[model samples]
Target chain A: MVLEATNNVLRLDANFVDYTLVAIYFVFVIGIGLLARRQVSTSLDFFLSGRSLPAWVTGLAFISANLGAVEIMGMSANGAQIGMATMHYYWIGAIPAMLFLGVVMMPFYYGSKVRSVPEFMRRRFGTGAHLVNALSFALAQLLIAGVNLYLLATIVNVLLGWPLWVSLIAAAAVVVTYTALGGLSAAIYNEVLQFFVIVAALLPLTLVGLHRVGGIDGLVDKVNNGPVENMLSSWPGQNLTGFESPAASVIGIVLGLGFVLSFGYWTTNFVEVQRAMASNSMSAARRAPIIGSFPKMFIPFIIIIPGIIASVLAPEILALNEGKGDGNIQYNDALLILIRDLLPNGMLGVAIAGLMAAFMAGMAANISAFNTVFSYDLWQQYVKKDRPDGYYTRVGRIATIAATIIAIFTALLASGYSNLMDYLQTLFGFFNAPLFATFILGMFWKRMTATAGWAGLASGTIAAIGVAVLSQDALGPLSVGAIDLKGQGASFVAAGAAFFVDIVVSVIVTMFTQPRVESELKGLVYSLTPKEDRTDPNEKNLPWYQRPVLLAGISLVMVIILNIVFH
Target chain B: MADTDKQAAKEKRAIRAFDIRTIIGALLGIYGVILVLMGIFASDSDLKGGDGSSTNLFTGIVLLVVSAFFLTWVRLRPLLVPEGDDDAADAHIE
Candidate 1:
């Protein structure tokens, strides 16, 4: 903790009033939380904001869901470690995934009025499938929450010189408390405030970092001449044959992550899914992600550019220690280093505050969504049965506290990892890929049975765990090199295999399992269509235009473009 | 008989237009699936280099073109509502 590091660590002209400006900025966020408390009442109101938010709110909330310290820290670290290829995560990965989800997948959730994604799956598939998806989601979020808190701590430790644990505890406590008190409404409102502050504070820092580094051209020249820059330019493969080729490295980034990872994230993750569920209408839900996607276009420039610049600024420290040493790259430390050694005093505090906002936005979103799923899908749907509005609100608060505790424990455990970004991404793959496969299969394919969903989930989990364990042993012959197997990719492969297996098995089993009763089938399909249309005798003769088909088309076009471009 | 004949004519016209959006949407969705698949495999290749920057630029251009077409096409097509389709409950397109 370097809080007491020289006060004039990085001298730049600033007014004495900057401190006041920073304080006022925090107060504004707190004010949003307070004002939002009026919106939470019933369990639905608490969890989903009574399913009536405007597109902008949902849009801001969607971006805030991603505006975690892990993403910010990881993006910068990636830039420092991998060069410009890091931008592919957003350009080729996230944006298209988001648009696809908004247009193609959201209608089912909003149309059938599902409180949680797992519940929607259960309704369409079966309870066993629902449980697997639910548990996996909880596990994934636990890892995500942990990594997010760790990054927040690092930022605080780097800038404010505060103890990692102290910062972690403070961030966790504030986010948990506010989320518990106001539910999704408070989180969304607070997120809007954080979004503005982060952009205002960090955007300027990125510009200055580039300017000081003598712009992109200067940075590029510096990198070309530096020994450390060579490592950053090319990815090293453990196999050491053709595996280490720079072209292969780029392709891996474009395909492995840009498309597969992006689709899995936006389409299935609870936080992103919940944003659409919060919108007032299907149209609004669709609009939310489109609007949210716009911010992502600028994010790589704001976050990653600084890291690339940092590499040039501190090539000596950024050096990779191979063989005899820990091989520490300290890519994650670049942002804090920049703030402490680059930005002036008052602005340092403002930037730290912006980092704080990023952490809180992520924490608040997770807590709010976790509480919603637990209280609505798990609690009211099962435990309480019939409680008053006030009672549900109180219970929702308790659930929020419980979720916060789980997240804190997760964060504490996750803090031990040296590379926060790698851990976060890898850990997400462990569960996310499987969950996504099941959800996509369950949603689109009517023939997918519950048996298949459960089997896929169990098998995927086992496969991921197996690979993770074996990869650790010397005899296992694991050769990913810098990449960890127990991390996201192994899980993703296992999950994907299970999903494909389930589709085949479920189809086979369904033949023996008896088709869903005509009554059940009718309820499922007809509920998704307008009642009057269903009742019409000449429905086939009516216009064949379908909204899902239209949306799905746009999603298809975008995905194709991303693949082609990134490929 | 005249009224029935008139109604049938309108339905025929609506169905023709309806085919446009559904066909286009379906085509776009197929493309999206392909792209996702390609992203998975392509990520392990050379699509991410300074020299590879051309690949990204080209892909982006294709996407912009396709998206522009789909967006414009969808707007041009009207919702193909069935006659007496008043049950708002079925509006869900998922």
Candidate 2:
């Protein structure tokens, strides 16, 4: 039955027209990248686009840089399995954190004029904390880039029957060519272009799927009649409620993902923050994330809705091992299956191109972030001091190439991990959960000594890892009744546990240690910063409706309404 | 005279918005029309894939409109070369 079910899923073979469409996409993207090269004249331009991007460009790239291969593939798969519950990652998890970054944290990040997040850590905490962050972030970015490359290669292999190595090398070559030549400017520009391609490709797929599933009403009816319970609900509750797991309690979701993971990634991660930092003005920097939140609010309709439709229409294909026994579902195949079964020849080509765009954009974003951090925070600071400007630029390009090679090897290593998305999130828990705790204390509490910062980070990471290891079912010491909190639940619990550990350790250490001098703490801590330094001057000039705060408020309200309606 | 010309060229290059409009506009316009045509002459097999709907036509039209917007935006407010010191500290870091 399993074999037959797998065979039933449609396999698309691209015609000349489809190939032509993909070729054109490549031409335009590379052309844009090469054109952007003309803008790169300095190390700053190579790494930071000379800090001259307008709000619109940076804003779009800010979100697009994150809409990588994993997000589109993994979220859609989660949507199929979890129903409306998956929307929590966007609404409850992402929006508020983004607004927080724009409103509160941007003043510190952009105001401090730090080249990267680790640089901020160095200034606030000390070099010990900085090295810990820079090394971890650089390694994590490389691992993620490899994961994306592997995922894209797998898709191309499955669809076109091309050899995996061929696909991997081709993708690496294109990304390296554009990224090494154009730097961040090229990456950002391509990110914006990829955003459009993704929307153009996926939006049509959603519409077509909805039409096939008999629109929203039809979808609701089908899901209501399907095997999955509460497929349409977004709120937590009893058996049929959303977030069906006992471990996925409302508090767990709020604290684990919403506060810890979201803030860690959105506020501190250089991959995302670089976009906002490249904005031409302080006001634009503040506005970038807010502008991104608008499009972000509506993304689930395109990515998630198709997954829901698939659950009702094609459950056999989504089932693990083709719906055999108690195996895990092939959740990664969710988006690929939708494209193959839904889109016709010409449109099929366009959609595949969009998928390719997603893969490359994701890889480029990570590589760009990796190169910047390595060159600025690690290399320039430690390896070579007082280097010429052109020297660093050359170093940056070399780093891009070296990182891509490392990423290719990493992608090969990641093949052992069956579920890419779950592995990615678990990795985030190991690093980001503890990091967020340290940042909160450093930013808000002026008394947080550098010793406290380093201690907090170390203890927090150890606690998170310890919890993750113990929670595994093989260990079984921490499992409740039928609920294996060590599985998917481990990430959530570990994050919350790490947060507490960091706070306790940080506070206790601070009391016994001497704080940094007030002179060194200026503009770095919240309480010590002046009013003019904290507030955006453009706020008074812009009308209330056009203000960043107001726009964020509107977005928050919309999310609340969506939760209620879906509930 | 040569120095002045060189300086002007530098200023223009610095001020220009990354020059992506023509590329995006041309691609969208071209593909948008093709999809529009495909939608019009689509066979019954094509319709089956879309669940008996003309999504291609609708999507094509939307793309065309978006392409037009990009073209119009470039025409109305061309990107300018940014002026001022490129490396000035805009924020108070100390």
- Each model's TM-score? 0.72, 0.92
**Which ranges in model 2 have alpha carbons more than 4 Å from their true place?**
A1-10, A237-248, A318-329, A416-425, A473-484, A543-546, B1-17, B20-23, B45-53, B88-94
Residue range A1-567, candidate 1, lDDT tens digits: 112223323232333333444455455555555555654534565777656666766877798788887688777776765565566667667877777777656666665667778777667666777766666666666566766766666555545556767877877777776777668877876676567557645665676667677886887787777544343332322111123456654554444455555676778777877876777656667667776776765677778778777776754335642222233335666566565455543344456667787887887777776766666566666678666555767877987787777877776666554344354445456556556566666555555556666666666555544444454321133424334433333433344443455455555665666444444433234333454422324423534332333443554565466445533
lDDT of 1 at A113: 66
In candidate 1, stretches whose alpha carbon ends up further than 4 angstroms from where it belongs are A1-19, A228-255, A321-329, A416-428, A467-499, A518-567, B1-94
- Give residue A408's lDDT in candidate 2 (0 to 100): 83
For residues A343-439, what per-residue lDDT tens digits would candidate 2 score against the true structure? 7777777888888989899999999999999998899888897765678889999999999998888777666554453455465547787887888
For each of the candidates, give the backbone clash count.
Answer: 20, 4
First chain of model 2: TM-score? 0.93
- The candidate that achieves the highest DockQ relative to the unseen native structure: 2
Error of 2 at A205 (Å): 1.0
lDDT of 1 at A467: 49
